[model samples]
Target: MKFDSVIMGGGLAGLVAGISLQQAGKSTAIVSMGQNSLHFFSGSFESMTEPPQRVADLFKDAGIGLHYRQGVRLMPLGTFRESAMSLEDIELFPSEKFARRVLIVNFQGYHDFFSSFLAEGLEKKGMRCRIRLINIPDIDPTHQGPGEMRSVQIARTMDRIWEKVVQEIRLLLKDEDAVILPQVFGLQDISVPGRIRQALPAKVVFVGTMPPSVPGVRTQMLLKKRYQLLGGTYLMGDEAIKAHVHEGVVHSVVTRNLDSHYLEASNFILATGGLFSKGLVSNPFQLYEPVFGLDVEFAEDRNTWYNPAFKEDQPYMGYGVKADDTLHAIIDGKPLENLYAIGSILGATHPELGSGAGLAINSALVAVDQILSEK
Candidate 1:
């Protein structure tokens, strides 16, 4: 199939670019290898260093509504806590009122989250918190190991028995002002929280945990739905195996799944992510971009890739494909006119410091603007 633009990744960057381009009346397609990092989303965009003032507008342009609050908010997981520059909209009890008393709920067999830890952290933050446990009869008898039970699995199970869980929550929330839940609200139903809110007096907030992220999954589904609604083609569960290039411009990308298929486009955006997504790889010698063979900037000595302190950012975290001022990939100081690199695949950004999403969104805006300008 052919389009005006083919986005090579289905993560935040690719989805943003696809939505922007498609909104600009360009025919676009997103070829992805199933779901991306959203499954681990923490219900917040951690753009501490460079908060995007246009975040609300970007989502609004895509027809995805979200609430944003400036300044850092403490995100608690178990007993640990971290900070995010901004938080997306969440349903809170007292229905828009500050939660003076918060009830944290956990499932007995769900190992993905612990209420006690969150309660402790929230208490430390000077919030009044209490812990409540709900035992779902169907889940207890399954005999699944902790590792075998993922957030998605529990979410699906909870969704199937939602009425029963809701009744139980109604009983537990009698005295609570708000309830904090693990991210197992629902997969595609963005209105789940709102529905729950209507049924109860307390506010419901879904916070994500380790892997198989609930909030991240929600954002992914929301963006993909908006993209498709805008007439953008979405090919899920496919991996780009080869790039057909000529004179430094990527003409098309070949994807492999059940069979090989070629996707031709007038322009390409490589949002294929960094080390985690294997967009960039390292051999015994040096780091290199795997798909299009774009040049990567890295320290020559492998010993310099890591620091002695584990908590500190590693050198390899900043290694990615080099991009020019227009956000296109640069090979040996020459720009690949039709090929742009966005998101975690570009070099010198520290995602560990909470600026990853902002960088991705801002760069995507720049890339799409450049594409429209050239057209």
Candidate 2:
């Protein structure tokens, strides 16, 4: 198969890149190895603690509509910590107005979320909050423990009995200003929250937790749908295993599935993500970019890779392929003529901030702009 542009990795960056190029009348293809970290998405996009003015414009041009908010919001997870959440599918009440009565809804047998913990944190923050645990027998028939059940399972089961759940919530939320729920809405049900809000008297907000992220999956699906609508080809459940390079230029890439197939492209964008996604690998002493053997920037001594304090920022988080201002991957101190890198793959930021999605989206836009300008 051949395309004008081929994107590696189907994460936020790769999908955005595909959409941008396809909308520009370029024939694009996205080679993905199944789902990316959107399964663990934190329900928001973070560009920085304070994103720039251009970030909004960039998102608009990329056809990604996100609810832009400033500053950080406390994610309702273990210990209730502060994280950046720029975009939200549901309506998020401002922190100041959140002093009203709040009801946190949790599903029975779904151990990924702890409503009590979030309620306590909100109470400590001076918000009048309480917990309401709804026992949805259909969601977990066997009463599986936390380790046994996945977030996706609960979300799917919830979809099967959504009307009942909504009716129960309507009764439980009397006089409450807002309803906070675990990210357990259906996988593709982006309209469910809005529908619930319209049916209920209070506002609705979905908080993110660990893996099998509902919001993350929604975002990924939204991006993929938009990309396909713009005539981008998506090769799902396939991986780009090798690149046919000639004199530092990647002429084509080989993907693996049932059979080995090649995709030829004039331009390539690598957004396979960092060590977590296996885009960059590391040993005791050296870091390696597995696919193309691209140059990686890391501390020589492994001891400097991590801080003595576990909670402190680690050096390894900032390690990734170095890129030029045009978003081209830099190898041997020179930029690859036809290859560009974006998202977590080209890094100098802390992963703890959960800002990779925003960075990925913005970098994808920049990379596409450069690609089109050069054409």
Once model 2 is optimally superposed onto the true structure by TM-score, how far is the C-alpha of residue 149 displaced, in angstroms? 4.1
The total number of steric clashes, by the backbone 3 Å criterion, in model 1 comes to 4
Tell me the alpha-carbon RMSD of every candidate. 4.0, 3.5
Superposed Cα RMSD, model 1:
4.0
Error of 1 at 123 (Å): 3.5
lDDT of 1: 0.74
How does model 2 score by TM-score?
0.87
Tell me, by TM-score, which candidate is best. Answer: 2
| Model 1 agreement with the true structure over 102-149: per-residue lDDT tens digits | 888878877777677777776765668888889987566377666656
Clashes of each: 4, 1
Model 1 residue 311 lDDT? 82
lDDT of 2 by residue, 29-142 (tens): 998887687777776665554455555544555444566545345576523433454444544444534647898888767777778777877777677887888877676647
**How far in Å is the alpha carbon of 16 misplaced in model 2?**
0.5
lDDT for every model?
A: 0.74, 0.76
